[model samples]
Target: MIRKSRVVLLVLAAVAAGVLLTAGFNVSPIARALLGDKEKPALIPAAAGLRMVPVDIPQLFKEVSPAVVNISTTQLMKFNHPQMRNPFGRQDPFDEFFNNFFGRMPKEQKRRSLGSGFIVSPDGYILTNNHVVEKADEVTVTLLDKEEFKAKVVGTDPKIDIALIKIETKKKLAYVALGDSDKLEVGEWVVAIGNPFGLGHTVTAGIVGAKGRIIGSGPYDDFIQTDASINPGNSGGPLFNLKGDVVGINTAIIQGGQGIGFATPIQLAKSVLDQLKDKGKVTRGWLGVYIQALTPETAESLGISGRRGALVSDVTSGGPAEKAGIRSGDVIVRFNGKEIGDEHELPQAVASTKPGKTVEVRLLRGGKETTVAVTIAEMGGELGKPAGGHDLSKNLGLTVQEITPEIAQRFDIENTKGVIVSGVEDGSPAEDAGFNVGDIIRQIDRRPVSNIAEFTKSAAKFKAGKTTLFLVERGEARILLTVKNK
Candidate 1:
């Protein structure tokens, strides 16, 4: 009986102790989730080895936004009929209504494309693309500080797709300095600040995907390709290096692709800007040669190990190359001491060179390397003889002309050759006959017509709706043609 009474006393004491312990501390949900009915204390979180500090992108925007200018163009275009126009492009019903009501409507289309530009000089000089201001009737410059000024087009080079402009403002405009684009490495961090989608001061971050990408934008296409999100209004904005210098001019992008964009290297822009500011016009060197890319078949035929370098299809008579003894079938391997990688690279190297400067041209002839010095001549000047004109133009859009003694000697054509038609009109009768320019006419209708008069008589028969046979000479080769008048 005493033992039972003692057990009851102990059980009551245990219950009281349990109640006191439960009152002292409650189990956290986190601890209860892991330990279930057995309540336990939660453990304190330990600090990680390293923590990434949050970056202040707004600081970058504030630093570079002052140097970037918002370029808005106003062009006077005469629109005839449509009341509400959709110039921005094909959009749905809402886009059409937005343009019709809010945007430039049925009135004369003073169509203008809004883009971005950056001041490269403290003196108010700016750099942009040629397409941005090419046909701009009036260009208005607006700053990030809400100031506007009229800008003048200083100089433009459409070939390289760069332009220089000056704004008449003495308000101490903020400008970005040009960086050395030649020293930029792939995967370097780049920031593009521009007004994209008409949104004000949009800045995007990316890395340079590649350098010297040929996007077929122009003759000189050594553009820096980036995965930067360049869009509609980012055309002329400054692509900044991490040092806050302008490394490139944000120019183009792949429309449907994400993050594929291109820019004009600041190095090329600097040279063009200097020339544009001083000379008002760009004078490019002329090599006077029609070149084509070497294909695999051409490489096999030439017994070349690799299909590279520009192939001289035709050399202009009395041009800089011809003056230096450069001839047809010669492959230009090097120009001005730089190796020619392909056909397009040759043009850029040649055109960028100064006129009247002698350049070393290394060419491959008969599997032998030949060296020649060519003094570049001015382009677009009228010479005494018709340089590109062939009698091909006169005879129904087919330019054909007698190969002069000089041309025959230059191109290595036989002196006793008939007038050659160099090009034929597409869908024209000559195209059906498979007649191309550079085909030397040797005989007509099986009758030997050496001179122009005899050739004219045979050609006249074809004019009266008759088929005429022609024996054409094509580079130490001959081809027969039976073309009937259509």
Candidate 2:
């Protein structure tokens, strides 16, 4: 009976102790006594070593926003109807009647637009997008202190959509330093300061979503993608890094897309900034060679080892490439000591090179590697044109013509060896096979076709409903296409 009573007391004591521990009673001393706690080892948080230092964005904006400016432009647009004519000049009877009835359509209209810019110099040199003041007759810049100034268009490069404008001001102005955009990593914090929707000096923060993004804006399509809220007036605004340096220019946004924006890397702008400031235009170097991506299939067909370089489709006659002895089917692996990774990289590198400067071009020809010295030329004027011809294959929808001296001079073609494609019937087999007007037919089924007679003879042997290989020169590039004979 005594033993049973002692067991009941011990059970009741355990229940009471548990209730006391659950009801906010101190139990650490009791645990320490049982667990032999050595100064109670400090508890470590899960994210103790992985915490990121928060960026002081407010302080960053305070230092950079003064340089940001609001840009407004006015353009005069003229409207002319097909039948509308000057009342003082001779007019058709029907045109005169239409004008008299319509009371002379509104002669002109004024277009106004708003954009953003940033001062890059204390002397008031501002950088903005070329499209902002492209055809603007009057440009006004408003500063952070509500001061306004008439800005002059210093220079513009429409290809890359960059403009340098100057505001004549003696007052001290804050300027943002240009940062190395190439060093900017993806996921780094960035801030965009602009006048979105004409709302003055709006700031948005986001991380660099990606770099080297191609959105088909132009030939130089390298853009930095961000999730920052960029709107219409944000065009030409400065995208600043954490160090208060301008790293990118907020340029474009996707319509109906949330949090998708694009900025032009400041590195590209810096490349032409001096030229834009001095020459009032950007002069890009030209290589005068048509190039295509070296795909695996193309490499295998060319007997090349790997697709690591740009494949030369065609070399322009009398141009830099032809003068340098670069031929069609050559793969350019290196240019001016810089390794060419792909076809896209070659154009950018060549364009960035100074015109009239000689550069070394390393290429592979027929499984042999060789280097050639070529002088770069200024990019301008139309490269080539099509020749007049007669229909050679109605079923194939191809028109061929022999290259005559008259035709060569008329079309500005230096080499007159291959037959030119004059036309391709729409929706025909040849058109579907990618045959275009102005294509020079060089070979059919591995047989050379130098003229109309050769082309007709080669094309006549094509079997109906059989696919035939064709090699053609188009726009300084040679390409192989397959056409299923109809």
Candidate 3:
């Protein structure tokens, strides 16, 4: 009876202790001790690590926005219609009746467009796209402070779509420094400042999506693509790197793409900036050689270890290349000490060089490398000469014949030295490889095929499933064609 009474007193005491614990009593440490577990220290975050800081773009915008100006152009467009009434003065019934019999006189219409540009110099030089002010009657530039000035076209390069304009201003203006576009890397942070949609001084930030993009805008299509928001009014605006230097000029955008935009590299603009500013024109060096890209199959057939540089298909008669002993069937590996990586690169390199400057040209002829020093000539010239020809019947399904004196006179071939293709079998390898009936085969597998004996010898060396490159003269241009022998 005494033991039972003691157990009842202990149970009552335990219930009171449980109520105290649930009511916020300090029991965690006591419970741990009772369970033979060690007490853990309270968790406090460490404070020694560096924290992420946001990019400060407001200061950048403040410094660069003043240089970005709005460009508005007025073009006088002409239209002709017989039934249209004149906008000026009253319409005459006699004029309309006379116009019904003959054609109506052309009417002038004013077309207005808006775009963007950036000041490139403190003395009032501005850089913009050529299409913006092309054929424009008048152009006006509006600055950030709401000041307006009349701008004049200094020079335009339609091939690359770049132009330089200038405004006569007495006071010094803010400008942006040109950056080295060749050093621009993909994924680097960039900012685009422009007057998009006529919205004044808009700024957007994005990373460089890619570099050296060929969007087929022109012959020189090296562009910098970015994900930054660029609109119609953004054309000719400057694309700036993080250091506030202008690296690219906004030029084009993909129609359906969300963020895809293209810009002309500033490096190309700098190459001709002095010429545009001073002469109001650009003069590019010309090598007088028609070149094509070297494909892997073409390089392999020629025994070239790597597919690099430009393949010369034709050398203009009396041109710099012809005078320098450079010939067709030669692959140019380097020019003026710069290594040529693509066929497109050579043109840009050559065009950037000064005219009449003698430069070394390294080429691979018959799998042997050689160098020649040649002086570059001014562009915009024409020359022609005829190559020898002969015909042959081989596995490739083409028939060739030698160019006799009578045959040369009939075909208008000068200094006839190659064999002319007389026939190409339908759906044969030759036809599929772009060979025509009038094409003259001058070289086969880099070997000259001047006569029937040479043609027969070269044709005998062709193997099935192996590529055979042919130096063909079609019309005035020399082109290279490759066929996989069947």
Candidate 4:
């Protein structure tokens, strides 16, 4: 019986050994089965084809640091000294002698600032923020090799905060390749090279936190948010992707906020690069329309299904939009075949388009889609205001009068055919509707109100508890306001 039991044990041991070999030398499966343990699959499977590729950050920095540069600027600030006048209004002879000897107490002082930039061309055309070299009397660029060269300001766009500068160099310089910022995905790693705290050629690494961020810096506020340790001297530095391509320009940082930095996308810089190179400034296309975002409530009121377009609040008189038959209340869905996702998108799209190019504008009017061709116009200077006039609509708490020649001259108004708002009573319907003094009432409920008589006639037609649309010309822009009659 002992011999038989040994034979059976030997056979079981052989079977267990065979099982372990078949299971890729894993003894845990057999041991678990012997212990009556249940098996569980891995939470993350190895067969999912996911692999980690280590990045050589040092190698990348070495390759791209040659194109990065440190910028130093000097500006002269002059201050006028308050003159010590005699109580009897008599000139003191001693003051002139003191000023001549002391050189007017050093009226001017040199203000020096430091920033960063990157080379974009072989001939040494560098790109940096406008604020860096905006009012500087002198700008100097220093390369990684410690070679310095005086730079000339080629062009500057203050609205977008980009500046193009050039340095005279006989030798070809290294430049960074511009990448498509629109393709940069969130959470992807990015590298920033700049002169942070005057430490030239400083490099930092982080992932993109967000894109298309608006910090209210200017009209064009689209920025790439990153945590790449950008500082005051890092302004106008280059933000690079893994491929060593320039993706963004480091431009802003939140005060006292850790790891919060903003960059201007390379795409925006590219859009105006040629213009900046050739014309020394950027000329933007204008639509002459005041637009607002289509809110859910506004969309529903307009019988629209989705809030995906820009609601036109007003159209500028004699502007490109008005000439194209685009009216107030129209929702702009697309511009030049590009989809306008919101009100902000429309402005950027329109401004990027070359002026004098006629583009198709797709819009929704009263629940119906339509398209119009508009010839783009160059954006002009500011518009003039209108002077106050006599009272016309007392019930609406508005004081308006006809636009007279004297009033037009006083206010610099070119058009003298509309009714100008003189005053608005507090807490009244007109005041609540944003009726301001100097607003020229051109139309009421789609009817022309050329003068105070016409405005009075139109005001009498307002129904109690009903909303009425008013088209007013304020400065150079036109606006649409709605007032509920009480």
Ranking by TM-score: 4, 2, 3, 1
Q: Residue-wise lDDT of candidate 3 within 233-307, one digit each (tens)?
A: 999999998778999999999999988999999999999899898898888988889888888777777667788
Q: Ranking by lDDT, best first? A: 4, 3, 2, 1
Point out the worst 10-residue segment of candidate 2 by lDDT: 37-46
Q: 1-486, model 1: which lDDT tens digit per residue?
A: 999999999999998876556455664433343344332222222256232221334566787788898888888887553344357654457656766676754556687788899988788998888888889999988889878889999999887778888998657778887899999999877789998877778888778899999898876789998877899999989898766789999999886988899999998888777789998778888888767676654454444557668977556668887789886557899999899989878987888899899989998776778899999987774422212223332333455667778768877764455777667788776677677777777666556656566666666666635555555666644455556565
- For all predictions, the C-alpha RMSD in Å is 17.1, 10.1, 13.2, 8.6
Q: After superposition, how far is residue 215 of candidate 3 from its true place, in Å?
A: 2.3
How does each model score on TM-score?
Answer: 0.65, 0.76, 0.75, 0.77
Per-residue lDDT, model 1, residue 194, is 91
Give one clash count per candidate, in the order shown. 12, 2, 10, 0
Between candidates 1 and 3, the one scoring higher on lDDT is 3
Tens digit of per-residue lDDT, candidate 2, span 1-486: 999999999999998887568444454543443444434221222256542332356777888899999999999999877764467666668786877888656889899999999999999999999999999999999999999999999999988899999999778789999999999999887889999999899999888999988888887888999987899999999998877889999999999999999999999999999999998999999888877777665565566798788887666667888888887778999999999988878888898999999999999877789999999998886654222117469879888888889878887776687798888888888898788888877777656777777888887788887777677876545776767787
User: lDDT for each of the candidates?
Assistant: 0.74, 0.84, 0.85, 0.85
Q: Which ten residues in a row have the lowest lDDT in candidate 1?
A: 383-392
**CA error at residue 391 for candidate 4, angstroms:** 4.3
Residue runs of model 2 more than 4 Å from their true location after superposition: 1-55, 80-105, 382-433, 437-440, 443-448, 456-486
Model 4 steric clash pairs:
none
Q: Which tens-of-lDDT digit does each residue in 1-486 have in candidate 4?
A: 999999999999999887666454454533443444334211121244452221455777898899999999999999886555577877676666667787546789999999999999999999999999999999999999999999999999999999999999899999999999999999877889999999778989888999999998987889999988898899999999878899999999999999889999999999999999999999999988887767664565466779888888777767888889998778999999999889888989999988999999999988999999999999866522322117556668889987888999999988787799898999999998889999988878767778877887788888887777777888766666777788
Candidate 1 overall lDDT versus native: 0.74
lDDT at 152 for candidate 2?
95
